[model samples]
Each structure stands twice: as C-alpha cells, then as structure tokens.
Target: MIKAKITVTLKKGVLDPQGKAIEGSLSALGFEGVNSVRQGKVFDIELTMDDKATAEKSLTAMCEQLLANTVIEDYRVEIFS
Candidate 1:
C-alpha cells in the first residue's frame, strides 16, 4: 500500500479573503507581529498499489482532474511507504 499526502494552496497574487479574515481576527485577539496568512488544504490518501511511480502519477492525475483547481491553486504530492 502507498500513502500519499496532497497539499493545495492558492497561487501567489491571489486574494485570500478567508486568510485575511483569520489574520485580522488573530490580531484582534492580541496576536502580534503576524504579517499575513494563507489558507490551504491537505489530503491524506492511501492507495492499494505498491509502485511509487504509478501512485504518484495517479495522485497527480487526481489533483489535476478533481482535487485541485489548476487555474488558481497548486497541488503537491508526497508518497510514503
């Protein structure tokens, strides 16, 4: 079995209203020196296959097809045995 971790985040220069709101709320709660915040997503998946290469390819395909929004978001995949 193969375990894959996927991270999806907004591209640079994209406005993150949710992140900005969180940052503002943090500041309001007395958290200081926080420059900015960017929100992202992480997905932990398990594959029935054993080949890392195939697993990676499938994971990438999943990201491109449905997991991540390629236009505004970037996704990274990491595999573990």
Candidate 2:
C-alpha cells in the first residue's frame, strides 16, 4: 500500500483572504511578530497500489482533475509506503 500527501496552496501572487483574516486575528490576540499567514489544504490519500511511481501518477492526476484549481493554485504530492 502507498500513502500520498497532497498539499494545495494558492499561488504566490494570488490574494489569500483567509490567510489575511488569520493574520489579523493573530495580531488582535497580541501576536506582535505576526507578519503574514498563508492557508493551505492537505489531503492524505491511501492507495491499494503498492508501486510508488503509480501512486504518484494517480495522485497527480487526482490533483489536476479535481483536488486543486490549477489556474490559481499550486500543489505538491508526496508518496510513501
């Protein structure tokens, strides 16, 4: 079996309203050093296939197809057994 960890985040130039909200909250809570915050999504997927290559390919396809908005988001896939 293989496990894939997919991390999805907004592209660097994209505006992250959620992240900005969190940063504002942190500052309000007296986190003086809080300069910026970026929010992202993580998905842990377990695959029956044991081959790492195949699992990676499948995970990438999943991200490209539905897990991520390719136009404004970037994704990284990590596979482990």
Candidate 3:
C-alpha cells in the first residue's frame, strides 16, 4: 500500500478570498505578526502498488486528474510510509 498527501493551492497571481478572511480574523485577534495568508486543499489517497515507481505514477495521475485545476492551481504530492 502507498499513501499520498496532495496539496492544491491557487497560483501566485490568483486571489484567495478564504485565506484573506483568515488573515483578517487573525489580525482582529491581535496576531500582528501575520503578514499574508493563502489557503490550500489537501487530499489523502491510499492505493495498492507493486513498487515505488507505480505509486508515484499513480499519485501524479491522481493529482492531474482530480486534485488540482491545471489552469490556475498548483499541486504538490508527498508520499508517506
């Protein structure tokens, strides 16, 4: 079995309204050190694989297909033991 942790986030030029809201709330709570915020989506996928290469390939395909929007989002994946 293999585990994948996928993170999907808006591209740098894209605006993140949810992240901005969180930043506002943090500031209101006196978190003056908070400068900027960006929200991201996370996905955990588990699958049976014969080897590491297969696991990585499957994880990449999963991210490309459903975990991220290729037009305006960036995605990263981490494999866990």
Candidate 4:
C-alpha cells in the first residue's frame, strides 16, 4: 500500500480572505509578529497499489480532477510506503 499526502494552497497573487481573517483574529488574540497567513488543505490518501509511479499518477489525477481548482490553487503530492 501507498500513502499519499497532498497539500493544496492558493496560488500567489490570489486573494485569501479566510487566511486574512485568521491572521486578524490571531493578532487580536495577542499573537504578535504575524506578517501574513495562508491557509491550505491537506489530504492523506491510502491506495492499494504499491507502485510509486502509479500511485503518484493516480494522486495527481485526483488532484487535478477534484481535489484542487487549478485556476487558483496549486497542489503538491508526497508518497510514502
């Protein structure tokens, strides 16, 4: 089996209202020196296939097709056995 860890985040130059809100709240709560904050999503997927290449391809397809919006988000995939 293979475990795939996927992280999805907004592209640079794109607006992130949720991240900004969290940053504001953190500052309000007395967390200092926070220059900026960016929010992202992580997905851990377990696959029955053992081939690293196949698992990577499948995870990429999943990300492109549904997990991420390619227009505004970028994703990175890491595989572990």
- Steric collisions counted per model: 0, 0, 0, 0
TM-score of each: 0.98, 0.97, 0.89, 0.98
Off by over 4 Å in 3: none
Give per-residue CA lDDT, model 4, range 49-79, as digits (tens).
Answer: 9999989998999999999999999999999
The CA-based lDDT of model 4 is what?
0.97
Model 3, residue 72: displacement in angstroms? 1.0
> Which 10-residue window in model 4 sums to the lowest lDDT?
49-58
Candidate 3 clash pair list = none
Q: Which residue pairs collide in model 2, if any?
A: none
Evaluate all candidate structures by whole-model CA lDDT and list the values in order: 0.97, 0.93, 0.87, 0.97
Task: Return the lDDT, model 3, position 55.
Answer: 86
Shift of residue 70 alpha carbon in model 3, Å: 1.1
Cα displacement (Å) at residue 19, model 3: 0.6
In model 1, what lDDT does residue 20 have? Answer: 99
Candidate 3's residue-wise lDDT over 21-76, tens digit each? 99999999889888899999998888787587888888889878877898999999
Ranking by TM-score: 1, 4, 2, 3
Model 4 CA lDDT for position 45: 92
